[model samples]
Target: MAQVHLLANRKGGVGKSLISLNMGAVCADTAGARPDGRPSVAVASADPQGTSLWRAARLADQPFDVLDISGDVANVALLKSLPYDHIWVDTPGWAEITPEEYAAGKDPLGDEKYGTLLSALLDQADDVVVPILTEPDSFEPTWQTIEWVLKPRNVPFVVVINNWPPAEGIAYVEGTRAFCEGHGWPVARTVIRRYRVHTNATKVVTQYHNNRVELQAREDFFRFALEHGMRTAAAKEVVS
Candidate 1:
């Protein structure tokens, strides 16, 4: 059976789609592991932003398909029917934050749709990966979303630190770690450093194209996935 991975976080601007595309490539491009000659990977854009669709059109040569998922039950059912090795979903950030914004509440997930969507999404996902920014502003929503997902669902997830600029200093990074540890969230050991190349490449619909710095970041992410018992090259090695 194919594994389903959802790139989800209620926090916007957390680099969710970019990570979805790159990680999908990592699965599709596993060296020497395509002998089964199957369509091994795909990305689903559950957001209205269509980030994955634009990226797919730009690359044109990516090995997997890009799908769109509205809230429609039919589309969701079709996705569940597909035979794929890795189905990755990029969900809208803070699908539940609209109500919070309206209420002037500090809780970001105050909207009800967020809860509905999150419940449906988690029901289909084997694992959820939450990408978080290290600053104070991004931290609360990260925890809020985590708490929401874990209740009565037991959805397994990991928190990844994104946009981590070295110049931001270790103090902020350490603080983020302390917060996660205090709450018992799994923080990926590999921190994806902020890089100019990541920003530049995203401008042109570049999929799976990385410079040295971004490539290093990709490796770090892969290591985290490996350590967490998620699929990686090591799993492919068995098939190879």
Candidate 2:
């Protein structure tokens, strides 16, 4: 069965699509071809926006396949049985936060259509990656995603701090880390730093011209991938 990695956050505008594309590419490229000739990795977009699918379409060649499972009940049903070693899902932003919803203790995924598709895909998620910015405003939603959704359902996840700048975001980086620590949440040791190369990236980092900047960008993901892999392996070992 393919290990489905869900890149999700209650709030949008994070690096979910970018991570879904490049991280899958890195793992696919590194793992090389499967013996059965199937693609080693794929990215499935559950986001209504189709950011990952649209970006993959623009690429002349993709290391991994991209699937548009948005609003597709059939596709989501057979997601786990797909012939890939790994699958990354870019989930849509959740429904708007309303006082009534909170008071009622209801956590909605989105509108009816979106909620249905998201619920189906999320059911098969083997792993979840929650990305957040350094700003304090992103914290409450992150907490809601963790507390109301993931924790209640017993979903395995990691909170990764995305788009950090070496000089500009140093303090905020620490603040974010501290926040995660206070909550006793698991945060990746790797910090995905901000660069024009990432926010404006059109192609996979490996597909870039292979310059120093691109190499650095790829390394950041590689490090995180390594850490993520180890954590996943450890979890499996414990389960076994």
Candidate 3:
């Protein structure tokens, strides 16, 4: 069975797609870094927008399978039976709904138009990698996201602070930690700083290690992905 890592959030623009692509690729690129040769990786996009799928198409060489399972129930139900070691799912932050439905009150997880797909993916997830910015607006949705989707299911997760500007985010980063600690949120030590290379990635991070800036760009995800992989393994062991 593949160990699935879902990059999820209730707020968009938190770097879910970017993390999906990099995390999956990083796990794939490391190949023999793990004892079992790390095997295969598949990134499935569960969002209706398919941002990850669209962006992955532009990569010169795809290191892993990118499945568009936005509305594919059969495939999602069978994800665990797939032959990959890891499968990263990029989920939607926003749901599709009519104005009437919106007025009625939206589902924090999703709406009828996209709810089923999200539910299926969530069911198969071994763990969720929740990305969020340090800004105040990103906090509430993140809290709602974990409380609504993860806690009920008892899914283990790591809250990764993304898009951090290293130059001036020291206090903000520390404050995020304080905030997470106050609320008992499981947070990743890694902070993915904003980078031009990330905003315009054409290849996997490993492919850009020749340059200093690029290495730094890949460093953040490398650490976080490794941490995530270890957590997945540990979680499975406990389950066993």
Number of the top-ranking candidate, with lDDT as the measure? 2
Which model scores highest in TM-score? 2
Q: What is candidate 3's lDDT per residue for 149-233, written digit by digit as tens?
A: 6887888898999999898849999987777777888888889998888877687676665678988988998998777767777
Q: Is candidate 1 or candidate 3 better by TM-score?
A: 3
Per-prediction TM-score to the true structure, in the order listed: 0.78, 0.94, 0.88
lDDT of each: 0.69, 0.84, 0.82
Q: Which portions of model 1 show Cα errors greater than 4 Å?
A: 31-38, 78-80, 95-115, 201-214, 228-240
lDDT value for candidate 2?
Answer: 0.84
Residue pairs with backbone overlap in model 2: none
Give per-residue lDDT, candidate 1, residue 192.
Answer: 72
* Deviation of model 2 at 85, angstroms: 0.2
Task: Decide which is better by lDDT, 2 or 3.
Answer: 2
Q: What is the C-alpha RMSD of each candidate to the true structure, in Å?
A: 5.4, 1.7, 3.7
For candidate 1, report its TM-score.
0.78
Model 2 over residues 1-240: C-alpha lDDT tens digits?
888999988888878998888889888987877897767899888888888888888788888988888878767878889888899899888766665786687655655887777677778988899998898888988888887778878889999999887878488999999999899889999999887877664678778767888888778888989999999999899889
Provide the lDDT at 195 for model 3.
86
Name the weakest run of 10 consecutive residues (lDDT summed) in model 2: 102-111
